[model samples]
Target: MNKAPIVFLIGFMGSGKTHLAKHVSGILTGKVIEMDSEIEKKYGAKIKDIFSEKGESYFRELEREVLYEIIATNIHSTAPVLISTGGGTPCFYDNMEVMSGAGTTLYLRPSNIVLLRRLEKEKEERPLIRNKTRDEILEYIKQKVNEREKYYLKADIVFNPVNPDIGNLAQLVKEIIYSSFPYFG
Candidate 1:
């Protein structure tokens, strides 16, 4: 039997990576591995607490370790594995290269307006934008998205979802994945 494909969903926070992963996994009967949740579980702390206590450098190291561990454990599975990575996952280390080499990387590109609206409501939960005002949050999104575009664009598939609904987006992603890897379908 062919080894199942690992689909890495890459995008900014609030771009629906986790939602997409869960939806796609349901459609594909795959496993969803949320990188941040895995790290939080492994360290026994929430990500915000981890960042506040250990610094981003330390948190990034942990992210790298978890990314590799996820790949190693799931790379040869007989069912699909959908990995929903943190916003900064691909921008650090050789993560983009590693993910692309291991399996398909799908970048979910949404407009800045869409991101700002979604992120503003959830700022308290996100460490990077927790204390920012509305304008500051928008500025931060623009700057970070610009900086991370290079890494995100390196994905094998770049999907710009005009309609951000999970059902439609998930169906689109499923079709793209099937087209890319026919055997998986």
Candidate 2:
């Protein structure tokens, strides 16, 4: 079997990166590293709280630190490693370059309508759109997605699922990795 030691999942908020990472890890028997969760655990504060207290720049710095830490510790791991990055992770610093160089980078591109619907349900949990009205949130999603697409499109693999099936998606990723590094087996 081909083993991709690390796989980074990048996408907009509410794009199901964490969920897909968990599913992929379960299938591959790998470790799942949620960057936002890691930051929250390390700093002892929710992400929204971090954004409010320390600001976006501080939070982005923390994100960069956590990303490097994860790579440094897991680069040589024997088992697969699935990393679910924050929406803006790739857009900051040289994160896109670092993650792409480290291992496979997968971009999860869901439709804007889908993102809007998902974000609406969990707006309060998201610091960026927490205070925005429904209409404002839609506009924000459109604007942010357009701005972030450049960074996100730099990923090695882009998986745009019309209706994402976690199981199938995980298997597809495995197949892609297997194809990419046939000598790994």
Error of 1 at 110 (Å): 0.5
Tell me the tens digit of each residue's lDDT in model 1 across 1-185: 43248889999998989878788777876677899999999999999999989999999999999999999999887767788999999999999999998889999899999999899988888999999999999999999999999999999889888876788888888787677667667
Global lDDT of model 2: 0.88
Residue 10 miss distance in model 1 (angstroms): 0.3
lDDT for every model? 0.89, 0.88
Over the stretch 90-150, how does candidate 2's per-residue lDDT look in tens digits? 9999999999888889999999999999999999999999999999999999999999999
Best by lDDT: 1
Off by over 4 Å in 2: 1-4, 181-185
Q: At residue 74, what lDDT does model 2 achieve?
A: 91
Model 2: per-residue Cα lDDT at residue 112: 91
Please give the range of 10 consecutive residues that has the lowest summed lDDT in model 2.
Answer: 176-185
TM-score of candidate 2 versus the correct structure, residues matched by position: 0.93
Stretches of candidate 1 above 4 Å error? 1-4
